[model samples]
Target: MKRTIPLAIVLTMGITMMVQFFVPHPVSVGYYDLTTRWIRIVGAFALVLGTGSFIMFHSDKVRRRRQGWYYSIISLVALVVTTVIGLGWGIRPGSILQNVIYANFLVPLNASMFAILAFYMASAAYRAFRARTKEAALLLIAAFIVMLGMVPIGASIWGKLPELAEWVLSVPNMAAKRAIIFGVALGGIATSLKVILGIERGWLGGGKQ
Candidate 1:
């Protein structure tokens, strides 16, 4: 009975939403609009619930003095400080939260994180581009051409390198991208249908309905 009621509501709403997409009647459109508005209200409550859970989880860690508990304290402090600042000053342009916390702190932190990520990406690329096999050699050559073509040195070395790079990108790269997108779309549809039909009950929390 605990999960049954929620599952029933989900099934009804899912079918209604799917039907509304195909049937453009006034009633269907109005129901969709009303449901969306209700969704926003529900989302607000969910946010509050999530925040409570986050605080409780960190608070337990801090109380237990677990390994790396200091990081949890920092997380909690940051959350509270940001929440207070946002609520007190508002996050508008030129506000203290925007100019001080965001511009001065967050922007540089994000840039530094991305800089570190670039090194990791380069390391991965170096390993992947090793020309041990024929396929690996082909990939390495394509990657080399693409990278070099973006710079002035490639044009200086060979006049047609840029055009060759453009063809590789527009032809093979785009074809692969479209194939992946089609696969993803079909998978999404299958997953959605499973959820709508209640075949996917993992959302109910326990293993296998």
Candidate 2:
């Protein structure tokens, strides 16, 4: 009984949503709009649940004198400050204090996070690149080619290197990204259907029907 209820909702909503794509009627369009709204509501509720969980976890860490209590304090302070500022004064980029927050806090923090990726990439290259075996040697060669191809030095030395880099990035890279994106889009539609029909009860946590 427990499984059957959710399964039935999933089947009903999934079929209706798929059919709505073909149907061109007022009723079908209405159903689609209603389902979309329900999905949005569920998403908002999920955010609330997530925020509550985050606060509870951090509060417990702070209470227990955890090693990362300082980070917890910082996170809570940032959240409260941001919320109060946004609510009290409009969150406009033109606002001096908001601009200060963005300049001093958000821009520096996010930019630094991304800047660390270069160091991480260097470390990874050091560890991974070894001309040990046939496949490893081929990979090392390809990595070196791609890395150097992006720089003016290699492209200047070998004129075709930049062309090869462009082909790899535009063709194979785009194809792989498109495949992943298609799969993600399908998954999102399926999940939205399940949520609207209340089939994904785990989002609400298990409880008595």
Kindly give the number of clashing pairs for every candidate: 0, 0
Candidate 1: which stretches are off by over 4 Å?
125-128, 207-209
What candidate 2 gets wrong by more than 4 Å, as runs, is 1-7, 169-209
Q: Name the lDDT value of residue 76 in candidate 1.
A: 100
Model 2 compared with the native: what TM-score?
0.74
Which pairs clash in model 2?
none
TM-score of each: 0.90, 0.74
- Candidate 2 to native Cα RMSD, angstroms: 4.1
> How far in Å is the alpha carbon of 10 misplaced in model 1?
1.6
lDDT of 1 by residue, 1-209 (tens): 78888889889999999889999999999999999999999988988878999999999999999899999999999999998999999978899899999999899998998889888988987676578899978888888899999789989999999999999999999999999999999999999889888899887897544
State the lDDT of candidate 2 residue by residue for 43-139, as single tens digits: 8888887889888988888899999898998888888888777778877677644687777888999999999999998998789767889988876
Cα-lDDT of candidate 1: 0.91
CA lDDT, every prediction?
0.91, 0.82
